[model samples]
Target: MDLEPPLSYGHGICRPRGFAKDPLVKTVPAIEALHPEMTEWRRDFHRHPELSFEETRTAGLVAQRLRDFGLDPVEGIGKTGVAAVIDSGKPGPSLALRADMDALPMDDRGGKDWHSHTAGVAHTCGHDGHTAALLGVARHLAAHPPASGRVVLIFQPAEENGLGARAMIDDGLLDRFPFDEVYAFHNMPLLAPGQAGVRTGPTLNGYIVWEIAVEGVGGHGAAFFKATDPLQAAARLAAEISSIVGRYLDPAESGLITVCSLQAGHSHNVIPAHATLSGTMRALKPEVMELLYQRLETACRGVAELTGCTIACKRLAEVPPCVNAPEGADRAAAACAEVLGEGAVIRDHPPFPFTDDFALFLEAAPGAYLFLGQESAMCHNPAYDFDDALLPVAASIFTTLVRQRLGYAGTHARSVAPPST
Candidate 1:
């Protein structure tokens, strides 16, 4: 199946609620009430960025905030991650809402006043915004407990390295706070601020990293035929590997292979005995991903044989494509439209080449991953910053999803069953 569909193209149908309406106006008063504290929370996080799997300070703050919101908080999942449960006073099925809490390893070039104080660590991916938005939901939901069911607010770590979600699952996150449905969101820099792009199925691509090493014989520059240069062999491999995207893979299939790094010897006059090359591989389908990997290995081996060199290949990180459940995505879209307005939520756009760890969660539960526009530069760029204006919209959307799934309006409140210990 062609997994690279146009953005916002959900196979399931949604009831029309008019064109592009603002869904937050009704909840504005409530959000406004919480705006000051939310902004402070985001700024504090922005000033202190933490890299993947090293979110101690960030995780601590999240746990403390959840406790203050009256939710029982659990920490140390996935090493430096946290999860909290808000049990409503009524009865219904449980729901989960997740937000990633790890920052990228990069220098902040945005020059914002609240830029990262930790050298070489920054929230270039807008994780600070995601964390604060979820915190906003926790605070709001705490003040006004949902009418029924329970809410599991997850503050995940190591999203940049694609390990947080996997860690939580392995640690029995679902078992601790079992739920019928789960949901998560990411901030997209390309889209306009305050606007959201939500798709029902196959939203993000799959990614794999490969490292190749070529070994040859070193010799002095004066030697005419004594040295077998691994650098030349590696160069040939890079050029040939680039063709995997264009020739080996189907033209219709979306795939990319880029050789990002190549390292060799130090002396200018001598041929290096070994050369190392590393790059990323991306595809929208599993078969295509496998095809790319196989083609790359074949190309590298062929180049090594022709050049009289030894080749070694290692597969690094592999993340599966994020496929949203059709029914779950439909429900999320309706909830988004109802909370952010039909106009504020755009249903169609291009699929992101980037990968998300949330795909792991979808494997165990029905859920949807939506994008909230940051209105800044692209993610991973040093110029990126989260637009605080979108926090209320996100929080309101989260709140609405909880209320809708539990079948409660704003007025009535209830308590839910305690999760089995």
Candidate 2:
């Protein structure tokens, strides 16, 4: 097999040539040619990461890029979300592609030259890369207009706290950009590069973050029965919290509950009057999550009764399970296979333990969530970085979905013309 010389651009992106010879790989050559631009956009986003609902700069840049691609973008849909459309001017079903745009409220230690400049915000979850890839798709679609149907591009905010999708929906996103189906992707380090994971039904879990407060009287440390100890009550509740899933849920069903943070005393000699515990519970089903909540309340009540303290439990945030529509999942798998070869698309993988707000989009319309393989530390890790190589790979998969599902007539595949020197 002869390999063509690597394509080099001004920004130093060298893509391996000769993809046409491989029968299974159908990645768009034009998208691959846009690698340098995408890399620049991605790194720019990385350097200026923003927290949820505060993506003014990121949204502005994304809107400007969409405009540069010759598409009209509507900004501020979900406070800081942006949406644009590319219509083929023919009658067919509408498709929506979404990308998240918020960064975690954490410090970046990735050590890259383009690492986050924001003091307390970073794109540790690869939202920066997701936005850039989708922007590439926007440019490609604008250049090579689809022959029929509408392709909606959505850049959403606040996904880190699982509120972006709902925010958009509440802001009439579905009504304004009405799509028959939606699609999104997240980068995963668990799989090898050049691979994609697509699973039908229950691709990611639903979760709820909860907090419990235990109140008791403050007393001297040496006193035996002078006062009730809230710290001891909080500790007992924390220990019992882990047992709720195993005791209430079925042996085969998946459930989780963990006490992540506990606060009570500030000194060593005095017993504090108040103790608080916070954690999360997750399940693949809504009813199971509710069950876990009920069990948690029961545990708190029991501990309060046993330790003579007043206990209160509260649910902070809730995101439902992300179950993929069968048809959408099949189409996504085929599209990924087109870009990464048949063997690179995995369909037998188990549901991921993480949660995504995209689940809400699936509830509103039929769609699928996919995982793009990458070589890096897992997302949310301080040292994590997004792989630039997957930029074209993901864009091609999204583009293939448009070409395959929304047919393009009379347009032969053409290589992208390099920018004028």
lDDT of 2 at 34: 90
| Model 1 per-residue lDDT tens digits across residues 228-318 | 9898999999999988788877687788888999999898798889999998888767788889999999998899889999999889888
Estimated TM-score for each candidate: 0.87, 0.89
Q: State the C-alpha lDDT per candidate.
A: 0.79, 0.86
In angstroms, how far off is 418's CA in candidate 1? 36
List, residue by residue over 1-421, the lDDT tens digit for candidate 2: 0111122111211123333223445558888789899999999999999999999999999999999989999999989999999999999989999999999988899999999999989999999999999999999899887888999999999998988998999999999999999999998776667667899999888989999989999889998479899999998998899888777899888878989999999988899999999998888999899989999999988998899999999998889999999999999999988777777788877778889999998998898999877777778888898888788888989999999888876556643333323
Q: Which parts of model 1 are misplaced by more than 4 Å? A: 1-24, 89-92, 409-421
Candidate 1, TM-score vs. the true structure?
Answer: 0.87
